[model samples]
Target chain A: MSDIYTNNYVIVAIFLILGVLLPVATVSFVGPLLRPKKPTREKQTTYESGNIPVGDSWVRFNVKYYIFALMFVIFDVETLFLYPWAVAYKELGLFALVEMVIFISLLIIGLIYAWRKKVLEWN
Target chain B: MNTLLQQAPSWGTTLWFIIAAVLLLAVVLGFVTYAIYFERKVIGWMQLRIGPNRVGPLGLLQTVADVAKLLLKEDVRPQHADKALFTLAPILAYAPAFAVLAVMPFSESIQFADLGIGLLYYIALSGITVLGVITAGWASNNKYSLIGGLRSAAQMISYEVPLVMSVVGIVLLTGSMNLEDIVKAQQDVWNIVPQFIGFAVFIIAAQAELNRTPFDLPEAESELVGGYHVEYSGFRFAMFMLAEYVYMFGMGALITILFLGGWLPIHPSLDFIPGIVWFILKFSLYVFLQFWIRATMPRLRVDQLMSFAWKVLLPVALFNILLTAVVVSYQNGMF
Candidate 1:
C-alpha cells in the first residue's frame, strides 16, 4: 500500500514536469525556428484596435471584483469543511449531520446577507 | 497493474514510468487535435455550414493544419508587455491543464495514479490554470486583455465553489474521494438518478469552468475582443487554446466518472461491451453536448454570469449535499 502511494506521487511529479516542458519547449525552441520575427514600431505597439494606445493598461479595476474574491475565499474555506465530514459521515452518523446542517445554515445566512446587500447583484 | 505498482523501485520501472507519461501526452495531444475538429464540425452542422472541408478529407486534418500554421506564425510580444510573465503564463496555464489528467481514471485498467484523494487532487490542480489565465491577461498590457483576465478569474473562482459543492454529494454517498471507488459504488445505479441536481449543477459549473458559451464572458469576442488572450499570437496563443480543450477532456472524463459511472456498462447485461468503449461513448456524449450548447446558446451578460454562479448554482449545490447526507443517514438507520 505504501509502495503504491509513493509510486503514484512519483508519476504525478514526472507528468507535471513534462507538462511544463512540452509547451515551453514548443513555443521557445520550435516556434522560433519556424515563425517569422520581423518587428516594426507599429507592429510592436500594444494592440488597441488599430489606434495609438492611451495611458498604462494596468490601472485600477472595479472594486466589485475584489468583493467577489472575498466571497470566494470565505465560501471556498467553508466548502473544505464538508470534505472531512463527508468522508467520516457513516461513522459519525446523525451528530455529524446536525453539525453540518448548522454550519451550512450559517454560511447560507451569510450568503443571504450578501444577497440582500446587493453584493451579489453584479452592478 | 496493482502488481506493477507494488514492484520494487528500479531503473526499469523508472524508465517504464517515463515511457508511459510520454505515451499519455501523445494520446492527449491527439485527443485535443480531433476534439477541435469535432467541435467545429458539430457546431458547423448545427449552423448549417459544411465547416473546414478544404484542409483534409472531411476536414479531418483541419486542426492539424491550423496548429501547424499557428506554430509558423510570428511570435509577437507587444511593446510594454511584461515579457517574462507573458512567456511564462502559457506554460503555467497549459501545465495544470495537462497535470490534472494524471488523476482521471478512464477505465478500470486505464488509469495513471490511483491516489486515494484523486478527486481532491483533480480539483486542486485545476485551480492553478486560473493563475495562468490571469497572468496572461495582466502581462499582455492591453486593456481588453486585462479585463478579460479579471473576468475569467472572477468567473472561474466563483463557479468553482458550486462545482466543488456539487461533487460533495457524491463524496458523501460513496464515502470515498477516490474516483474509481466512486464509480464502483455506482454499480447498482448511476448517481445521476439520486444526485440529479448535483449532476445539473456540475454540468453548469463545469461549463463555466471551461469558459464555454453562456459563461464565456472572459473571452466574449463580441465584447472584450478575444478576452484575456487578445494580445497573444502565434504559438503562445495556441498553448492557451490547447489548454482549454485539454481541460474540456479532463472535465468530460470527470463527469463520466462521477455521474455516468465512468467505464461501467449501462446495464449488467451489457457487460460484453468493453469498459473503455463505454467510457468513450459517455465522454463523447459530454463533448457533443458542449458543442450543442455552444451552437444554440447566447453568451450571458457578465453580471448575469456572476449572479447565476453565486445566487443560483451555489445554493442548489448546497441543497444537494444536504439532501444526500440526510438520505444516506436515513438509509443507514442512523436518524
Candidate 2:
C-alpha cells in the first residue's frame, strides 16, 4: 500500500518536472534558434497605445481585489472541509447530514455578512 | 493500473511512464491544433464568414502555419519588465494546465495516475494557473496586463467556489472522489438528470474557469487589450494560448467524466460502439458549446460577473449539495 502511494506521487512528480521543462526548453532553445533577435530601444519600451509611457506600470491597484482574495481564502478553506465530510458521508448517515447542514448554514451566514458589507460588490 | 502501481518501483515501469507522458503530450498538442481550427470554422459559419481556407486543404493546416509564424516571429520583452518572472510566467501557466491532465480518466484503462484523490488533485493543480496569470500581469510592468491579470485572478478564484461546490453533490452521491468511481456510479443513468442543477452550475462555473465567452473578463480585447498576455510575443504568446486550449481540453474531459459519464455510452444498447468513442463524442459536445458561446454571447462586466458568481451560482451550488444530501439519505431510508 505504501509502495503504491509513493509510486503514484512519484509519477506526479515526474510529470511536474516534465511540464516545466517542455516550455522552458522550447522558449530558451528552439524559440531563439528560429525567432529573430532585433531589439531596438524603442521597440523594447513599454506599450501605451503609441504614446511614450510616463510612469511605471506597476501602480497600486484597487483595494477591492484584496478583499476578494481574503474572502477567497476563507471560503476555499471552508470548501476543503466539505470534502472530508463528503467522503465519509455514506458511513456517517443522518447525524452527518444534520451536522453538514449546520456547517453550511454558518458559512452562508458569513457569506451574507460579506454581501451586506458590500465586499462582493465589484465597483 | 493498480497492478502496475503495486509492483515495487523499478526502472522498466519508470521508462514506460515516461513514454506514456510523451505520447499524451503529443496527443494534446494535436487536439489543441484541431480545436482551434474547429473553433474558427464554427464561429465563422455563425458569423457568415469564411474561417481559414488558405492554409492546407480546407484549412486543416491553418493552426500549423500559424504556429510556425509564431515560432519565427521576434521574441520581445519590455526593457522595464521583471526579466526572471516574465520569462517564468508562461511556463508556470502552461505547466499546471497540462499537469492536471494526469488525473483525468479518459477511459476505463487509459488514465495515468488513478489517485484516490483525483478530483481534489485536479482542482488544486488547476488553481495554480491563476498564480501564473497574476505573475504574468505583474511581471510585464504594463498597466493593462496588470488589470487583466487581477481581473482573471478575481474571476477564476471567485467562480472556483461554485465550481467545487457544484461537484460536491456528485461526490456526495457517489460517496467517492475517484473519477472512475464517479463514472461507474452513473452506469445506470448519467448524473446530469438527478444533479441537473449542479450540472448547470458546473457548466457556468467551468466557462468562467476557462475564461471563455461570457466570463472572459481577463483577456477582453476591447478593455484590457489581450489582458495579461499583451506584453508577450512569438513563442511566449503561443505558450499562453496553448495553455488556454489545453485547459479547454482538460475542462471538457472533466465535464464529460463528472456529469456526462466518462466513456459511458448514452444507452447501454449502444455499448458496442466502444468507450473511447463515447468519451470523444461527449468531450466534443463541451468543446463545441464553448465556441458557440464565444461566437454568440457578449462578455460580462466585471461587477456583474462577481455578483453572478457569489450571489447566484454559489448559493445555488450549496443548495444543490443540501438537496442531494437530503435525497440520498431519504433514498437510503435514513429519514
Candidate 3:
C-alpha cells in the first residue's frame, strides 16, 4: 500500500488501542485504586430479582435468535454486494441500475419467503 | 492530519498520531459527560421535574459527579460468571464505540483518519459492539442479562441491515464511501432532500441501532430489569453507559454527514458562520432529537421491534437504494 493509505490505518490503529486502553485503565487500574473492595458471597451471587436462582442461565435460548442471525447473514451479504455497486453506480450508469434492480428483487423474494415461512415473527 | 497521512511511518508521525488520538479521546469524553447531563436535563424538563440541581452550576457537572461516584463504588462479579469475558465485555463494547469516531469528520478539516472506506469502517466497527453485549450477558450467568443480551444482539443485527442499506442511497448518489466526499457532494443540496426515503429509513434504523426509546427492547427496564448490564456495577457498568452515549454521539455525527450535509450551511448567504459551528448546530439537533424521542415515545414490543426492522425498515431501505440508483442513472443520460 501507498504511504497515505497505510498511514490512514495507522491512525485508526492508534485510536483503537487508545479506545481499549481507556476503559481497561479506568475499570481496572484507576478504578481499583479509588473503589471499595467489600465482597460478600451473596453480593457475588447472580441476581434473579431477589429470588433464589434456579437452573443455569447457559441453557438453550429461543431458536428465533438463530433464525434472525441466518436471515441477517443472507441480507448482510446482499448489502455487501449493494455497497460496491452503489459506490460505482455513477460510472456504471444504466447497466448497473438494471442489474441492481434484478439483484434486490431477488432478495426481496427471499425476504418474502421468510415472511411466509413465519421466521420473521417473534412467536 | 491529512498531511500526516501522506507521510511515511516514523517515530515523529507516530507520536503525532498518538497525541491526536488522545486529544480526540478527551473531546469525546467531554461530549459523553455533557450528553448524559443534557439527556437527563432535557427529559427531566419534559417530565416537569427538576434534575441534578445539586451538581455544579445548572447541573453542568452532574455527569462528572456521577462518574466519580461510579468509580468509587465496588466492582462486583457474579460468582458463576466467566471472569475473563466479564472483565473484557465492557472494554469490548466501548472500544468500538470510541474507535468509530476516528473516521467522523467534525468539519472539513477536523477528521483524524481519512480512510477511503470511512462509512464501511464505521459500520464494521459498530457491529462488533453486539458481540460485547452478548458476551456480557453470557458471562453474567444471569437469566435476565442472558435474555437481554440475546434480544439486543437480535435487535442490533436486525436494524443493522436497514441501516447499512439506507446509506447505500447516499453512497450511490455520491459514489464514494469516504465521508468527506459524501459531504462535498452535498455542496448543491443535501442528500436528505433527494434521498428522502433513505433518510427516513436511516434515521429509524439508526434509532433502533442506538437502542433509544421506541426501539429499546434489549434494555427494557420494566421487564428485563436493567437488561444486559444487570449484573454489572460500578466502573464496569459505567463503561456500558459510556458506550451507549458515545455511540449516540457517533450516530449523530454520521446522520449529520450522510443526510444533514455535514458542516454545510443551509444557504450560501449564511456561510459566514464557521463550518465547525454549522457542524455542531446540525449535530446538536440530532442529539436533542434523540432525547426528545426518548422522553416521548413508549418502548415497542419485542416482536414488534423485530418485525418492524425486517418488514418495514428493510424494505424501505431496499426501495430507497433502487430509487437512488435509477434516478442517478437517469440523470447521467443512461436511460
Calculate each model's fnat, 2 decimals: 0.81, 0.73, 0.89
lDDT of 1 by residue, A1-123 (tens): 777888888789888999999897999888889998999988889988888889999999999989999999999888788988898899997989999999999999999999999999877
State each model's CA lDDT, in order: 0.91, 0.91, 0.90
Using all chains and alpha carbons, the TM-scores for the candidates as numbered come to: 0.98, 0.98, 0.98
Against the true two-chain complex, what DockQ does each candidate achieve?
Answer: 0.84, 0.77, 0.81
The TM-score, computed over Cα atoms with residue i paired to residue i, of candidate 3 is 0.98
Q: How does candidate 3 score on lDDT?
A: 0.90
Off by over 4 Å in 2: B1-3
Candidate 1 residue lDDT tens string, B163-234: 999999999999999999999999999989989999999999999999998788888887789999998999
For candidate 3, lDDT tens digit of each residue in A1-123?
488777788888998999899998888789989988999999998999899899889998788889999999999988889888888888886777888888888999999999999999997
Off by over 4 Å in 3: none
Q: Cα lDDT of model 1 overall?
A: 0.91
Residue pairs in candidate 3 whose N, alpha carbon or C atoms collide under 3 angstroms:
none
